[model samples]
Target: MSDSSFRILIIGVLIACSLTHVRSDASDHRYKVGDVVPLYANKVGPFHNPSETYRYFDLPFCSPDGIIKEKREALGEVLNGDRLVSAPYKLNFRDEKDSAVACRKKLSEQDVAQFRSAVEKDFYFQMYYDDLPIWGFIGKVDKEGKTHPNEYKYFLYKHIQFDILYNKDRVIEISARMDPHSLVDLTEDKEVDVEFMYSVKWKETDTPFEKRMEKYSLSSSLPHHLEIHWFSIINSCVTVLLLTGFLATILMRVLKNDFVKYAQDEEAADDQEETGWKYIHGDVFRFPKYKSLFAAALGSGSQLFTLTVFIFMLALVGVFYPYNRGALFTALVVIYALTSGIAGYTAASFYCQLEGTNWVRNLLLTGCLFCGPLFLTFCFLNTVAIAYNATAALPFGTIVVIVLIWTLVTSPLLVLGGIAGKNSKAEFQAPCRTTKYPREIPPLPWYRSAIPQMAMAGFLPFSAIYIELYYIFASVWGHRIYTIYSILFIVFIILLIVTAFITVALTYFQLAAEDHEWWWRSFLCGGSTGAFIYAYCLYYYYARSDMSGFMQTSFFFGYMACICYGFFLMLGTVGFRASLLFVRHIYRSIKCE
Candidate 1:
């Protein structure tokens, strides 16, 4: 390690970072379905008419988001006999027949003016359905067959309607003549899909939900929307408990053994350094002989589990939608860099609490690994996207702006979080001090090392969840339409239970065989099963998929990301256990007398 080499390495990193910023700042968001994009301010170019387009006023803004409908005069001049039955409630539906059974409301002339004025004034929209455009109006048609800027269309409620919103945000507040009567003839064949074609916001004439439901709230109308509940919290708890319970049950059994008890007593003499809490911690800086390695491994695994949950929840809540028009993508790109801070803060602080030397090295490793590679990879992607207009394309300028935002906004936040975490001290107090010297050299063979134990521990759980994980991977990497949170909720709960039990059982078996290096082995043993899952993906390609060329390469890159992510999770677990083991070993060595 000469000075020139270190300087060159620093220079290389700087160049890579500069390139990323230049590319990330040149674009605006390009939203798609499932992206929680905001309702954009309408551009005036389309509506900057010298001559007015015909505008229909006094229309229900709340009428099924899109499609214009009027009353169908029952075959004209025929004698009226059969009564028409309308559906109980309205929903954005497909086809004229699907929208609703029939219109059921009565619209008054006075109500028209107020609703029209409100729609024109404050309502805004986000495009939902990319296939077609949707329009809203609140005016009337003039003599030239043009929609006058301000005029009302005399109509009633329960008119023709369509659901133009799907996988997009719906109006939080707005008004429409619910149960209105149909006025125009939109016959059976012309179908309109009920996805939100755009996002809509409230305005003056807009009626809030309370008032909108006022008329029909009397009877239970079709339920407005279903409640979405996630099982992650409960799942995380089950995961933690199962893992801990198994460890506790094993520890209790091991403590009951007379020989084991004697050895533990013999090793307790390592803690006599006696300066402060820091000195006591320093005694622990060696490999753990007991089950302490498994504990640290479990903690690291928990961190990875929670990280994924946190990110996904934020995405659903609109902070990081998948189709954030590149904004979300850019953020994802830079977030790994920030996660370095979290990893560093968590890893370094934990290890530091063990009273190990080389604090600076540990901190540096914590901050760089993933972030460094992630920055380089994204820059490469940006370069490719610029040269070729890929579907996952990002504008050069937008990329630059993204870089600035990441550097300015995310960098400080991470640093602050890291500092705060460092100051908090270790969350877990060491179970006991380390021994002064390594335990009586065990003659255990190489095959029983942490690697084998960890390998077995992670295999089955990964196998069980492999299929589900793949389907999810496809939705993202294969560019498929997937929006089933209900199913995901169920799957997450199941995985938590499975992974926890498997990790603990495997860790216990290794220790029973008297394997002392269970710390790193325990975590990776359970986590490396992801590598097998990746192998399954390869098999899937050869068997079921018909992907070709770029698709295949993309599949490779996508899986690469998954593997890298999994690698960190595995390694983080290993690192945590190793730190604890190192401390346990040192304490035992010193105190054993």
Candidate 2:
């Protein structure tokens, strides 16, 4: 063909392809009512407090498509017994006929007994599709009331119906509707029947999940809270900047004067005399007494720091698309196991630097300090969940998987990292040699003491993230969805900066008070922010939140303790590194003889 003819032909082909693409996009597949869809239970929560939620098993119902019908789990399957019984659901279309309901399987005496036990424990079921909760129910059935054993009181859903639409053999659409009765009195056991009624119809929609979410999931003001708190966040930023500026100015003036004094002629320098931190320069650089403990903490802190950064970055970048707590938790566990090398290296290197010889002991203790506590706590929590038959309890297979991750992935990485760190040399260099005997620390005033300094230093770092904490708390406890990774990232950075600066300032104050024992103080000062965070959590639980179940309460406080401990490690590491740099710079600048 000629060039002009070929070009014309190409244009025609391109046009046809574009048209086909548009048509394909516009005519996506449609779903029918009888076709069973996967019903995900993202997390189960108490009625009063949705924020405190736990992951549970999903439920599958039988539905028919054009060609096939999906089968439900076996009646004997004990999956999510708290929310649903294992008995098969026999469908009925009639609403008024008791015989039709009676045709369906009635709860056996054993089933009734188990169900009654679950209801007494306040167990409820909430169904979620896509990332939103669609249906919620409590096992409220008519049973003998405690007030009057002779009379029966209704407890569960008084009216339950499923609206289904089918076209010939294919089921096209489905939705659930229910009118729940007053809270059931479960104090007494009375055998009861469970039944479901259905109404059939047909409707088509482009976005089923979105439509369902709108109809079922109650809208919350969590986003509004995020927007409203922007001013307070900005205020916190400004306050942190001012405080850092003041601290920087004071340190600069003091250090500059010290440098000038030390730079003087021999006679003049002698007359001025090295005082405060300068007086104990030889002892300040001395390895702390609990070298093994220090090394272990530093290693764990480094690992947690990296994990925090990685998680925030992933969230900010939308890697955690659904942004559910379960996903976040899984990612953390996997990442932490992978990052064990970093933790091992940090601890081993620091321990070696302190001229300690117990490499194996240090590595073992390091792993135990953080990971051991976490594992123990997890086991305890899991036991509690199992006792309550809470879905949050991990299955045996999942527990095995976690153990394998720790033993195979984390443990090996720790050993490799410890070996590497032991082999490598640390860059830290002290201008003055450590003295054999420790310098006698002078008596300090109340304000200059370690407790006062730690208490005061922690507040600034906490303040930096206080505004953001509201949203974080809501996401964890309330039905609020957290998606602003950018905001979280910014807050994390601010927290780091505040922690470092405040810790340095506190260290300076302690040293100036003629205290040479700054090794632990620096870590404590920054790590203490976790204490404040825990305090705020208590305040939120008692004063700001509506959470009421003992299970939720236990879970919240239990997990919060672990979270705060990790926070302590991260912040403490930042502070210690900052203080170390600050001390090194001051000594190096001064001609310490």
Candidate 3:
């Protein structure tokens, strides 16, 4: 195919994929009175640990038929541990069903034991009908909701009442409630005949289809800490504003005075020795060691930065919502793959700017910088999930699909971007030229060392987001649903501003100390925030959360490592970009001869 045709085909494919996602849910279809409505049973897991889920049929539940049929789901759904399968409940649009026995089974001793165990762990089952999710407990503890194995009575919820609300012909909301009276006591060890019963009720409502998900957010069983989230956001904003104020003062007053003094000294032809940042102007722009790695990091960071902003923007516009299973993950994967070109262009352009050859090597490094680690981690996690028979495990087909996307879509775009970047004529716009011979650096105090500077620089940015991080952790690891994208976006912007200002301030200090090797140090100083975030993850795992087991622990830390690594790159790039601009402005204002 011609280049333009290939590009057009790729664009068309992407648009088709996006449109498919938008209309993936069954609710998007307009149904007549007798249209068949399918109900899909998702995963079931302990209420306390959200990440550890298994297929709904893992337990000894009565199947609709001897052979089970699985429903095809989106990539996001699979990643989020959703194993959607056809349920036995049969209903048509606008059709109401009285109490009906959906399935019947004679429970054996093993079956009773399974139910007992599930009830003991407080397992919850998730189901979807008309693209609306419904959740209910598998069983209940009878002793005043306490899980005392010796005293509390365990009962299986054998009957379910699906209350579905509709606006005209469109389903607006769905809720599942267990019939308390129909609970079957699992205290006995003997075999029993259990009849799984269900009733469907369709009611008319004024709520529109677009607003169907609002009920889930408002009436969620999980705790809503809106006030706490707002407080944290406000606190972070104040911290950022103060830091910005300090930075503005330095730029406006201190830097202005330094510029005036330097210009005056140049006019006087003073032979006095120069001090502070002014003394290191010649070496500040020197290309650092490991040019390939540095350029790759910047490129990956640029892609990640763009991905984050776009994800948040989509969430703000309601393209993703709490009830939409796997939507966020799906978006993340697709966007990351599509934005691979940004990374290639940035890495290539920056490498070219530094007068580095071996462009192919640089491009390869940029492509693998983040993805290599992520792929390895994912492989390990997938292996663990497979071992444990967890629903989080991706099927072989899904893995093949993802690999194809990376190989075909991501690799090609990255190469194209690299080609474009290499052909560009723009050069590195450094205000000062580097000296032929390197200058000898003076010894600094222990407190002024790179390590200390990184710690100090990283802590401020970490502090600004730790409170918000708690909420995010809860949503990801616990049962809470995160819906306040606006607050999250605000916190995200605050984090970037704080990171940039703090890194710039520290870079200024490093330069004043006559440290010409600020390239890697500045990057490390900003990236150190990821280290702090990982530390906080440890603290949260131990102190705040009750998540346990090898699978959950491994998954949590493994994925968190990837997330923090991305943060390190993205924020480090921000710091480097800001510091580069700051250095150029300061050097450019003076008469450098």
- The model with the greatest TM-score is 3
Candidate lDDT values, in order: 0.40, 0.65, 0.84
lDDT of 1 by residue, 1-593 (tens): 23543354344334323322211113232333344322111111012110111112112333332344431212110011111111122323221233333222233443444433333332222122221222333222223453664332332122323333222222222233222333321112222222112212222234442232233222212232112112333444455566657656765575345335445545685543423122323233254442323333333343344445544554444342222222333333444333434454555455545554455554444444444555676666545533433323344554566568557644554454445555767645545645565443245677666666556655645544554565555554443333444445555555545554555555544444544454565456545656666666676566645443442345356536655465546544643454345434433433332
Q: Is candidate 2 or candidate 3 better by TM-score?
A: 3
lDDT for model 3: 0.84
* Each model's Cα RMSD: 18.4, 10.4, 3.1
Clashes of each: 83, 15, 0
Q: Which stretches of candidate 3 lie over 4 Å from their true place?
A: 1-29, 32-34, 143-152, 219-226
Best by lDDT: 3
**TM-score of each candidate structure, all chains considered together:** 0.48, 0.77, 0.93
Candidate 2 lDDT over 1-593, as tens digits, reads 23543354344333322322111112232334343333333334455554334433321221222122222321111122213222122332212232222122244555455545444434455543212334545455455445663454435442444454433332334555654642323334554445533323334345443233233212233556556567656966897789889998999998777666656644464655667678888888988879999999999999899878767756665444432334455556666776777888889998998998998999999899887777787788777778766656666766677788789878988898899889887745887888889888888778887788889989888877887787789777765666666767877888889899999888887777778889999999989999999999999999888787767787788889989999998899999999999888887776666
**lDDT of candidate model 1 versus the reference:** 0.40
TM-score of 1: 0.48
Q: Which is better, 1 or 3, measured by lDDT?
A: 3
